[model samples]
Target chain A: MVRLITHNLLACHVKGCTTNNFPLVFQDVQVELQVAEFNPDFIRNMLSRLEWTALVNAAKQVGDTSLPPEQPDMMDDELLQKLHHVLMEIHVTDGAMVCQNCNHIYPISNGIPNMLLAEHEIG
Target chain B: MIPTPDLSHLTRHDLEQVYDPAEDTFLLLDALEQEAEALRKERPLICLEVGSGSGCVSAFLGKIFGQSSSLYLCTDINKHATRCTLATGKQNKILLDPITCSLAGPLSSRLCHAVDVLLFNPPYVPTDTDEASSAQSSADIAGSWAGGIDGMEITNRLLQDVECLLSPRGRFYLVALKQNDVPSIQSRMLEDFGLTSQVVIERRAGREFLLIIRFARTAHSGSGSTS
Candidate 1:
């Protein structure tokens, strides 16, 4: 659940903390790299859906800076391969995804991120 | 028919915490299989399942679309269920990412109108409001079927999000019982969200009359959700 693809989709959902929630700030993460079967089409398709800044910042938070600050205009194989690795292969087995806006912590343990909030925090 | 996902990896202890794949699960699988041809043609990229109990249905979806065509995302309140879902993906050679959270709660905003395929097999058993809320709070096996009021307390929450969740070409598949008032569900989705729907498949399993209803934006939008 710590895959960059999934991380990009997660935002702070705590009660009343709405604005500037996207791109949850990652902190104190233990990263694991597992090779996955790569599909260029999937990468290319996901490219459109990805929040480029969020992904780039998240990749760096987990200690990988290979991704460019901006999405490359060229969708070449070289770029696709890089996107595949950064998005699919990197796994954060332990740590927390802290919300920049609300400071809520979403923990990732044993490779699954617990995004469940407290009852009062659920909105 | 595509073979069901292998669940031999799931142990007895796992079932105690997670909802086991049973009649309702297979019914969702069967409905998905029935829609395989159209689903593939759409070439969907994002597939999300709410309350993915054993991860069986999403694994079957991987087999249908092939492993690399879509990103399979699942959400479950029960921690064991999410872990079981990840294991089932590994067992079946599919990549499934599971998040421990209530039904699509954490995913709603980022996935805004971006989900190509949405699924939910919510707790459809009518129970007391307190029972349902407690089950939801505890986030265990009981949460799988403790539907409050008209067996729709949970499903109703998701209904508010569906209109905004679906991509232009997106389709949502839901599992419900006849007691849930299937007709009213259809009418509300049409009247409120402008989403036209049709019952994809239905079966009477034991005393439960289960149905799979598929919904999408109206046909006049150039994308036909119905075959």
Candidate 2:
């Protein structure tokens, strides 16, 4: 599923797309929220690795605006719950992940993102 | 022994398109099972499988973790493989997020020095360059085994990015064949990227000799990046 957690780890890999390609923009996306076993500790551990700004951008793009604009230095349970919801609960069931740099459209269907590039677009 | 992921949900049509989990897949699972305690102790947050054809290996890894906190990420060229991977993950109750991409093409940079456990059971059969290219372009079951030029064409590209993708304490488990020049692969990784490796497990699977080589950063290589 296209969770913000996984989406945070994807960028446009189109040929020569070396800059401004992070947090692939979401467009016309159908988002689903499924019950998941939330582990606050897992979110805490992943906090350091997460690109806060990119994650916030992706969350908002997916119609979620729970996270604050800037990440809090100290994470409380309330903040962690919000992080878990934004990152883990929101799944992009159908839509396209567009590259901001090269404008390459990576379609997402059935919760799977097709990141394959065309022959001409391959680097 | 760790139990294999339940893949009964996959239909015969699915197996024909996706690479079926065979001896090679089982061997990879066994290797991971052997390292269960060590892997769990590491508490790896991000685990990625480069070509998760059947999602069997990654799903098994998830099983090893029990209450897995890790994010199991997967990538494959074949669309059918991705579909099957998701099905298998769901069947096994493991959340394997798969992307339909060539190897880890789009995720390399985003995953920079973040992956803790990286597994790859690549296409290791040595085929002609054209045949391999065609198989890759077709992105079908053939692409699962057509390894161009000594079965290193596809693996070599991923090797170049491994150092950059792995975290300081990351481990990369790769399944290779005897024909792929295993010793040379080990040497190249050491000389080129300062990544030392040990053959985790090996077996004679019919006519094909399979080995799972595990690589990790050298003791002194504090950083994952080359620069």
Instruction: Give the per-residue lDDT digits (tens) of candidate 1, residues B129-223.
Output: 99999999999999999999999999999999998899888999999999999999999999999999999999999999999999999877636
Q: Write the per-residue lDDT of candidate 2 for residues B194-213, one digit (tens) a residue.
A: 99999999999999999999
Q: How much lDDT does each candidate structure score?
A: 0.92, 0.90
Pull out the clashing pairs in model 2: none
Model 1 regions lying over 4 Å from their true place = B222-227
Per-model TM-score on C-alpha atoms: 0.97, 0.97
lDDT of candidate 1 over A39-87, digit per residue (tens): 9988998887889999999998988898889888888998899999999
User: Top DockQ: which candidate number?
Assistant: 1
lDDT of 1 at A67: 83
**Residue runs of model 2 more than 4 Å from their true location after superposition:** B222-227
DockQ of each: 0.83, 0.80
